[model samples]
Target chain A: MATILVHVMPKPEILDPQGKAVGAALPRLGFDGISQVRQGKRFELTVDGEVTDEVLANVRKAAETLLSNPVIEDVVQVKVVREGGCGCGGHGHGAGKAEKDLLA
Target chain B: MATILVHVMPKPEILDPQGKAVGAALPRLGFDGISQVRQGKRFELTVDGEVTDEVLANVRKAAETLLSNPVIEDVVQVKVVREGGCGCGGHGHGAGKAEKDLLA
Candidate 1:
């Protein structure tokens, strides 16, 4: 299996209230020097096969279409972190149940 | 200014409903081969100065305590993306108003 990471962030023009709240709370909680905090979404996708160029292209299309709202968010990254892992190693299938349901 | 990226994800044992929904929706939407999807948070922290060891330590503390819920979420990554920018170039301060309010 291959693991792909997709990072989605708010558009620079958009207001991120959640991030703003966290930024405000940081100083009150004694974490200083951080001037700005913008919160976004990260997705880890486990692919069933090798992370070939075709797979990357498909993943990027998915990232832009389903993973982010282009009006307010941007898909900043879609990179492969792991490629061609055996099914029985430390990268165990966490979505076995879901896969069964989908394939059934 | 410096930019630090913090990635927080659901614990492997935890249930990620958001991710499951996305995974289920993918094949229906014509994106295939993805077996699992895990959703998480990505925070871009724009710091006012250089990202020194002390700053990294502080950010790590903040990430664990405020950025992620240690019970269900894990701070998987805390890395510096950009270090010591002049602040007047393409990397303009997007959080200017927030920074001013916080500094005020």
Candidate 2:
């Protein structure tokens, strides 16, 4: 199976009351250094079968068209992780120590 | 500065209508192997000054008590990245090629 992760955020111009509140609260809780807090959404999905470029592209389109609001947010990063085993069989590269695809 | 990322999800017992809808949309998008789709939130915050254990802990507490819903989601992975020169001067270990602290 493949794990597809999606992150969503509000459009930059839009006021994020949730993010603002959290950002403001951090400083009061002894985290005096935090300057900003922008909240976004994450999704962990397990898809059937092997991962393919076409399927992934479709997932991206689905996310853009239906899942997230691109107007307020700038990026929607999607990473596909091949599951099962810890690479003992070398069933494709596992996520291993890495969590996100920054290059994306 | 440090980047504090927070992920949030609905309590498992509660019905996640948003996640459910996205999960349903995936199969229709030609992703036949997908069994479940759960959505969560992500926050990227740039903190002031250096990264410290106490500040990080406070950020976690703030997230739990005010930012995220701990019931449906089991984990909130936080990673501190010191940004500036890409480790040219080696000012503390940067996030570098990896993202997200899965160990947390």
Pick by TM-score: which candidate is best? 1
lDDT of 1 by residue, B3-35 (tens): 777778888899999999999999999998899
Q: Report how far residue B41 has shifted in candidate 2, in Å.
A: 1.0
Clashing pairs in 2: A11-A72, A11-A73, A33-B48, A40-B42, A42-B40, A47-B33, A48-B33, A48-B34, B11-B72, B12-B72
lDDT scores of the candidates, listed in order: 0.72, 0.60
In the range B1-104, model 2's lDDT, one tens digit per residue, is 65666656565566778778878876776655567777777777777786677777777776676676565453445555456212111212234343435223
Docking class for model 2 is acceptable
- The interface RMSD values of the models, given in order, are 7.0, 7.7
* Candidate 1 lDDT: 0.72
Candidate 2 chain B weakest lDDT stretch, 10 residues: B84-93
What is the number of residue pairs that collide in model 2? 10
